[model samples]
Target: EDQVTQSPEALRLQEGESSSLNCSYTVSGLRGLFWYRQDPGKGPEFLFTLYSAGEEKEKERLKATLTKKESFLHITAPKPEDSATYLCAVQAYSNNDMRFGAGTRLTVKP
Candidate 1:
């Protein structure tokens, strides 16, 4: 079975503070790792797709990196606007559907 677990279900940071969210997973065979951000009453917005270990993608103050067993979403000097629920998912080569983590809720205070 494939499963994902995200730590620190919630986070609070002062404006301009930096932190990282963790996503750990276990799969039969990793096809891809995906990162997304979701806002209240809105669907998740795609952030990055990691195809293999050691691969990374970045946008603005956010960076997503992947490894053999886990992935990390790094937030740098985040502002209030950066606050949202960050989601992580993984697809296994043997399965067509993706398994997702519970998501990490981040609040950046101004």
Candidate 2:
């Protein structure tokens, strides 16, 4: 069976501080992306993807990388407005829906 486990459930960082969020998975033939929800009533915004093992993608202050066993989302010098719920997901070749982690709720304080 495949699974996705995200660590630290939540994180708090001061403005201009840096940190990384983790998402571990057990799926083979991985294909999915990182998404972020800015508010409770908003939809998740697509941030980036991990098409293959060892692949990495970046957007603005964020960087995402995928490996055989896990993925990481690195944030560099985030501001308070960067606070959001970051999610990770993966899907094998045979599945129609991707498996998602619970999500890491990050709070960047000014």
Candidate 3:
């Protein structure tokens, strides 16, 4: 059975603090891994698309990396505006279906 799980369901950080969030997943015939950020009541904004192990992508203060069975989103010196729910989704090749993690809620306070 394929599944996705994110650790530290919630995180609180002071402005300018740095941290990393984890997304663990298991899938048959992996196709890609996606990272997204969603603000309250809003649709998720795409952050990255990782196609294979050792792939990585970055935008502003966020960096996403992927391996065979897991992915990580690293935030460097985040600001209050960075607060949001981070989501990870995986697509499998066989069915072209995507499974999403519960998400990690991050709060950056000043």
Candidate 4:
């Protein structure tokens, strides 16, 4: 079965606190890995697309990297505005459906 799991279902971070969230995945012939950020009551916003091991992408205070078996989302000096749920999804070559992780909810306190 192709699946994705994210650790620390919820994270409370003081403003400026840095952390890394883990995403473990089990899939067949990974076509792509995607990272998204979602605020409460809204659909996820695309962040990054990682195609292979050792590939990384970054924007603002967030960075994402992918490997053959897993992916990581790192946050640096995050602010309250950064608080949101981080979601990961995997695309399999054999299907058009995208499977997603439950998500890691991050709360950045001011």
C-alpha TM-scores of all predictions? 0.98, 0.92, 0.97, 0.97
Error at 108, model 1, angstroms: 0.2
lDDT string, candidate 4, 1-110, tens digits: 99999998999999999999999999898999999999989999999999999999999999999888899999999999999999999999989988999999999999
Supply the TM-score for candidate 2. Answer: 0.92
TM-score of 3: 0.97
Kindly report the root-mean-square deviation of model 3 from the true structure over all alpha carbons: 0.7
Model 2 residue 8 CA deviation (Å) reads 1.2
lDDT string, candidate 3, 56-97, tens digits:
899999999999989999999999999999999999888867
1 or 4, greater by lDDT: 1
Point out where model 1 deviates above 4 Å: none
Best candidate according to lDDT: 1
Least accurate 10 contiguous residues by lDDT in model 1: 90-99
lDDT of 3: 0.94
Q: Candidate 2: lDDT over CA atoms?
A: 0.84
Model 2 per-residue lDDT tens digits across residues 1-100: 8799998799999999999999998876666645555566797777887777788988899999887888899999999988989888887887788788
**Model 2 stretches astray by more than 4 angstroms:** none
lDDT of 1 by residue, 1-71 (tens): 89999987999999999999999999998999999899999999999999999998999999999899899
Q: Poorest 10 consecutive residues of model 4 by lDDT?
A: 61-70
